[model samples]
Every structure is written in C-alpha cells, then in structure tokens.
Target: EAQIMAEPSGNELASAAAKGDLVQLTNLLQKNVNVNAQNGFGRTALQVMKLGNPEIARRLLMSGANPNLKDSTGFAVIHDVARAGFLDTLQTLLEFHADVNIEDAEGNLPLHLAAQEGHVRVVEFLLRRTPTMGNKTLPRARSPLPYFGVRG
Candidate 1:
C-alpha cells in the first residue's frame, strides 16, 4: 500500500524520456504519473530526456515538467540541450519558459556550454535570446577549436 501511494521515483518516465518513446510517455502521463519525479539518479524525466527530440520535450513540458530543475551538479535540461546542440529541443524548452540564463554549479550558463562546445547555431540562437552573454567564466576554457578538430 505504501509503495502504491509513494510518489513515483520516475524511473519509468526517465527511461521513456531517455529513449524518446513518446507513446510510452503519453501512456504514463495519462495514468497521472508525476511528471517531475526524480529517479534513483536524482534526475527528473526532463533531466534525462533525449535531447534530440523536441516533441518529447514539448510533451513533457506540457505535462508540467520543471525545466529549470537542476541536478546534483546543478546542470539542468537546458544545459544538456545546449551542450548537445539540440536546437529544436532548446527552442521548445524556451517556449515553455525555461530559464536560459540559469547558471550551473560551476556558474556556467547554457550559453557558455554552447559556445565552448562549438555549436555555432546553438550559440547564435542562444545569443539572440540570452540577454547576457558574459555571465560566469569557465574554470578551464574549452575552445571550440577542439570541437572543430574532432569534426575534422
């Protein structure tokens, strides 16, 4: 009885989001599962969601997933989306009112991570939306130059 009444650990939701399984996610939401529940990893469905799928993000956000909730390292879903260069997902998150300026534990904003990772499009998009670019400096600067090398 206690297990039934306990708040969902979000393990299933996290897994569904991680896999980008919109059908399963929809089913879970229909069942009235908590959209923002954290899993054993201390991460929410949005936190572990597949960054490449904007529709999944849209669904989760519409279901009341808190986009600005950070994890142990203070990294939010926006941070991951920016770092991973998922422009669509980022757009969806912003549409849902995710704080583009929220800082991580290291004081790095999503813009910093986007710039450091050499996601030119993401940087440009974030630049247009982010009011402040010079928020906090990274402990060790990661040049976009390295990203180019990897691409090359």
Candidate 2:
C-alpha cells in the first residue's frame, strides 16, 4: 500500500495569504500542500484569506481550495466573508460554489452570520441570492434581524 504523506502545516499557506504573497502560495500548491490544511488555530488559508487579500483568496479558490471547508468552530470561509462585510470576497467564494445556505455546528447559515454582524450588503446579497432562504429552525425572533437593524 502506498503510504499517505502527512499534510504540511498551514502556516506557510496562511502566511503567504496573509502577506498576499501569491508567488509563494503558488509554489506551495505546486508542491502538493493541502490547500485545505488547517493551522494550529484550526484556520485554513482560505478561511483567513478573507481577512486580508481577497485576490489571493480568489487565486487559492482557483487552485482548488475547498470554499466550504470549515474551521474548528465549523465556520466556513463564506461565513467569515459574510461577517467581515467583504462583498467582493463573498462573491468570489460564492462563484467558487460555496454553499450559501450551509450551516455551522449550531445550524447558523451564512445569512444568519451576515445578519448578526450587521453586514447589510452581504445580508441583502444573500437574501437576493437565496430568495427561498428561510431559517425554519431559528425562531422568528432569532431569525435574521440585521436587515431590520435589530439583533437577535
């Protein structure tokens, strides 16, 4: 049986993303590093890529990064982009097929996160993107209230 090699720590990937070092990121990816590898903090390069350079994040996605890969807390890259109000970044991830209705461990979706963080643009985008969007499990009072300028 062929032995499966351990994935490299995500530190370099994360660092390259953090600094917008696309060259280094491209090199690491060429070396077969796990694009979805998580760091000590359980954050993958794509997860935190939203925090800094969206272009790098987009490139990573093009390099086959899993947009739906969740962190330790079960939050996906889309969730972070939603919370951060990065509409362009959010669009990039969505274009890469990030599930807009994907829920966290607690069953909160990207719309819920955008609503909670008061990212009106993201909330509106999600609302338009998923017209049938409904959090039936979340009580009406606990539903997406950011659009109404209220917190649940």
Candidate 3:
C-alpha cells in the first residue's frame, strides 16, 4: 500500500503563495509535499487563493496541482476561485478541465460561490462556459443568495 504522506498545511502554502515564493513551493513539491493540502480550517492553497493571489494559484495549477482537490471541508479550487471572483484564474482552471459543478459539504457549487459573492461577471463567464451548471438538490437561482445568504 502506498503510504499517504501527511498533506502540507494550507497556511504554510498560503504564506508561500502570498509571498509569491515559487522556489520554496517548488522545493516542497519535489519533497513530495501535497500541493493541494489543507490547513486546520480546511483551507487549501487553492482556497487561500480566494483571498487574492491569482499568480501563485496559476503557478500551483501549472505544477500539476489538482484543481479539483478539496479541503477538509470539501471546498474545491473552483469554488474558491469563484468566491474570489478571479476571472483569469477561473478561466485557467477551466482550461485545465477543473470540475465546475463540484460542491462543498453543504452542496455549494462554483456558481453558488460566484452568485453569493455577487461576482456578476464571474457568474456570467461560468454560465457561458457551463450552461448546465448547478446542484440538483439546491434550488435553481440565478443569484447565489440561496447558497450563501446575501452577497458577501
């Protein structure tokens, strides 16, 4: 059985991303660290990108990081990108075939994140790319209010 090494913490990777320290991250990856690992709060490097670091996110994605990997809370990279309204990052992820409809533990999809965050442009782009996007269990609403309750 392949031993699953403990995933790296989100905060560590997030900090590296925030500093745009690609070298350190590259070394860590070479050391077999989990690039998509999550932190104590269930936030992965991709999720931390939602806080504003498109360039780093792009680098990580290019380094074979799994865009579909979820944090402990089940939040996918697409969800974080959508929430952050990072159109460029979102597009890049899509180009890599990231799952657009992946949901969190609460069943909130990327559309839900875009809508809830009031990222109209992001939502529009995602909709144009994925017309059939949605969570069947959740009500179909154009706005994300239904998912996050009021734009945030």
lDDT of 3: 0.71
Candidate 1 local lDDT, 7-85, one digit each (tens): 3459999999999999999988887899999988999999998899999999999999999999998899999999999
Instruction: Show the colliding residue pairs in model 1.
Output: none
Candidate 2 residue lDDT tens string, 1-152: 97665655699888788777888888788878888877778888887763546788788888888998888888888887787888988888888999998888888888888888888888889988876665355677647874576665
For residue 148, model 1's alpha carbon misses the true position, in angstroms, by: 10
Residues 50-119 of candidate 3 have per-residue lDDT tens digits of: 4355667777877667888787767787887788888988888887779887878887778877877789
**Alpha-carbon RMSD, candidate 3:** 6.5
Model 1 regions lying over 4 Å from their true place: 1-9, 134-152
Off by over 4 Å in 2: 1-8, 50-52, 134-138, 146-152
**Which residue pairs of candidate 2 clash?**
none
Report the number of the highest-lDDT candidate.
Answer: 1
lDDT comparison, 1 vs 3, better candidate: 1
User: How many angstroms is residue 152 displaced in model 2 relative to the true structure, after the best TM-score fit?
Assistant: 12
